[model samples]
Target: MPVRRDRLRRAGESAFGALLLTRMILMTLLALLMVTGGAWSSWDTARDALRPPQGAAGPLTLAACDRERCTGTFGPSGETVALYQRIGREPGETLEVALRPGTAEVVRTGAPGVLYACLPLAGSLLLAGIVIGGGLRMYRTAWATAGAGIALLATAFALW
Candidate 1:
């Protein structure tokens, strides 16, 4: 009876080990690296947005808007700046914003800025789930991470 149990344990170990091959691990690592690279590309903007805002602060008088962006004039200087990928803004509406130093760009302040800043991380987490589940065969972790990402996105939408 003991011998039979030992054999069963060995069989289980072998089956588990089959999934942990060198090639599989390497492939999984490569995929994760790619995902990391993509995330890093967006980290710059996200990092800036996440920080306490600096530079000029005042109302932006929006002049023109299309689907991708809105152009506006900022403060007393009337420096032209732009806001990208944001919604609920109408032309000619004066929204409070801050200048991104050394550039003709602006970001929202307060709750909206913080919420928008989190978007990149949310997207990266969503992508990581695919890598973890498919390449690394970690379904539980994948689901948890992806769920967290989705929840963040939903929360931002509800509150932003």
Candidate 2:
């Protein structure tokens, strides 16, 4: 009976070790995916920023009319230019500016591409690390470390 028990224990240890190795490999893959996604996102943002403004009929100009009122002119196309008034503008100051199309849509569209790609990768890594680390710790310490790790992984997934 003692010999049988020792053999069972060894078998269990071997199985656990295999599980741990698998988890580690999965975590490494997730990390790599996250890094690649982040790099792609950075590149997209840079490309968008460097793009020149298009379809400009002429240069836009802004002239101060008074302390509170300002007039903006859109070159030959006579396109209605949106004006944003700053509170700090002093009286008799003419701030000439060129009107460009808003890039908010572009940024908004690009953000999801980056986040969706990276978030899943990071989340998977975190989950695998938590599960393996917690499982091993729990076996050694007979504590609730595994539960804690799972909870942390769940929290990260929720936030992501």
Candidate 3:
């Protein structure tokens, strides 16, 4: 009787430990997914934005060019492309720009295109930091990530 009780207790202890381990693994995986998905989304958008215009560069009839950005209709696709963080050109004047592949965005030939492309990436990192910190309890790493994102955004604005 004593031996049987001992065996049962041991088995229960082992099972409890296993359960805890499983829970930890599951939570870790979820955290990783959140961070990775956020970063990937940002990277994909940035990649598309940074890529140089493909094929022949075309002209756009500027519908409006304010202090912040320029909006114009691309002649090739007849689509509106907003040029962010770029110098404003005349509202009615035609300017040459390269259309971003698979997006309704444009970049001037000599503009700082990479900085503009990275704006969304910084935002994503900031959100990911919050998720990792609040959901996963990784406070240190989360703060660091969030800080980096803020710095990037600040840099973009300053340089713009």
Strongest candidate by lDDT: 1
> What would the TM-scores of all predictions be?
0.70, 0.32, 0.55
Which has the greatest TM-score?
Answer: 1
Off by over 4 Å in 2: 1-6, 50-160
Which pairs of residues have clashing backbones in candidate 2? none
Pick by TM-score: 2 or 3, better one: 3
Estimate, for each residue in 1-160, the C-alpha lDDT of model 3 and write its tens digit: 4545688898999999999777657766765665566567656545544554466357778888778888888887788888765444678877656776666776654333455556666776788687668766789988998998899878866654
| Model 2 lDDT per residue over 1-160, tens place | 3545588899999999999888767755654554456456555433433442464324444543445445555555654453333233343333323333562122111233233223334444445444444543324322243344455445534432
Model 1 lDDT per residue over 41-107, tens place:
6555655555625546678899999888899888756878998866666889887676777788877
The parts of candidate 1 lying over 4 Å away from their true place are 1-19, 27-35, 52-54, 86-88
lDDT of 3 at 154: 83
- Separately for all candidates shown, the number of backbone clashes (residues 3 or more apart, or on different chains) is 0, 0, 0
